[model samples]
Target: MNIRQDDPAAPHVSGLLAFHLEELRGVMGEHAFALDASGLSSPDVTFWTAWREDELAGFAALKHLGAGLGEVKSMRAAPSARGSGVGRALMDHVIAEARQRGYRELYLETGTAPLHEPAIGLYRRSGFVNCAAFADYQPSPHNQFMVLAL
Candidate 1:
């Protein structure tokens, strides 16, 4: 597997990331929480793309939220790449990258639905624990917040 930082605005990355956003919208309906294309390109955000051979496995991003904190955003494994370790690899990379950026902690918001269990398990295995909302996010029945001290 090859993982590298890339411009989320690039055609290929943008298209795949857009698919991820759309998938979230479908799953969460009016409560989808993904950042849009331009938001991914913000100065404080770092986007990463993963590939196995010539296949685009998936992508994830880290958003610096100031005060020694960072947020995990837009983590998605392509449908074909599910169960292939793409999500785990991408998550490990994000965690490491957040540490490298000097963040004291990393946080994320995911859904509480059964459809989100796999992701919750992923974060749990990665050392994240459930927490109250952070940044601009407000507490909501549809959202589950998690945090990892780095």
Candidate 2:
């Protein structure tokens, strides 16, 4: 798989992005934290897409939160790409990029629903440990916060 920097507004990414947002909204309702295209396009966020030859496999983003801190955002593997290592590849790419940028830590917020177990497992396997809320997020039973010290 080839992972490269991407534009959230690119036509090729619209379908998966919409699916990702819709799924998150369905699962988390008002608490969904996944970014829409406009949000991902912010100056502090960097997005990337994983491709398998001609097909878009998955996407993830990293947000710079100042002071050597970074947050993982908008991570999703296409339905067709799930269980094929796409998520792992995208995650590895994000973590590597954060380290490259000199971040001392990486953080993320995800849902606590059963549907989120797979992702939570992935994060755990990647060295993230549960933590209290950071940044502007408030404490919520529906939210799980995690961090990895780089």
Candidate 3:
């Protein structure tokens, strides 16, 4: 698989992103969608897309938060691409990008439900540790926060 920073507005990327949002809505409800800023135009944010040969494999984003901080957002592995290392590769790309941008820390938010276990495991294995809520997030039973010092 190959991963590269890409435009989210591309046709295939946009469709898969919609699919990701639908999946999130089904599992986490509308409140889960509240923090999404994927559709907005922001100079501080960048989107990455993963591909296997010609197929779109997955996508994730990094949002710059200044002060040597960065946030991970909209990470999604295509259902067909799960377990084939798409998520891991995307994460590796994000981490390297954050470091290249001079970020001293990287943070992310995922859910606490069983459905999120795989992702949490991935983050943990990638050197992230559990942490209190940061940025604009509030404490909530359904949310799990994590941070990694770069």
- Clashing residue pairs in candidate 3, if any? none
Over 91-136, each residue of candidate 1 has an lDDT whose tens digit, in order, gives 9999988888899999999998787888889999999999999888
Residue 149 accuracy (lDDT) in model 2: 99
TM-score of 2: 0.98
Judged by lDDT, which candidate is best? 2
* TM-score for each model: 0.94, 0.98, 0.92
lDDT of 2 by residue, 1-150 (tens): 999998999999999999999998998898898999999999999999999999999999999999999999999999999999999998999999999999999999999999899999999999999999999998777898999999
> lDDT tens string, model 3, 1-150?
878778777777767877877777777774463224445236788888899999999888888888999998888898899899999999999999999999999999888778789999999999999999998887777787899999
The lowest-lDDT stretch of 10 consecutive residues in candidate 2 is 136-145
Q: Candidate 3 at residue 64, lDDT?
A: 89
Residue 149 CA error for candidate 2 (Å)? 0.4
Better of 2 and 3 by lDDT: 2
**Winning candidate number (TM-score):** 2
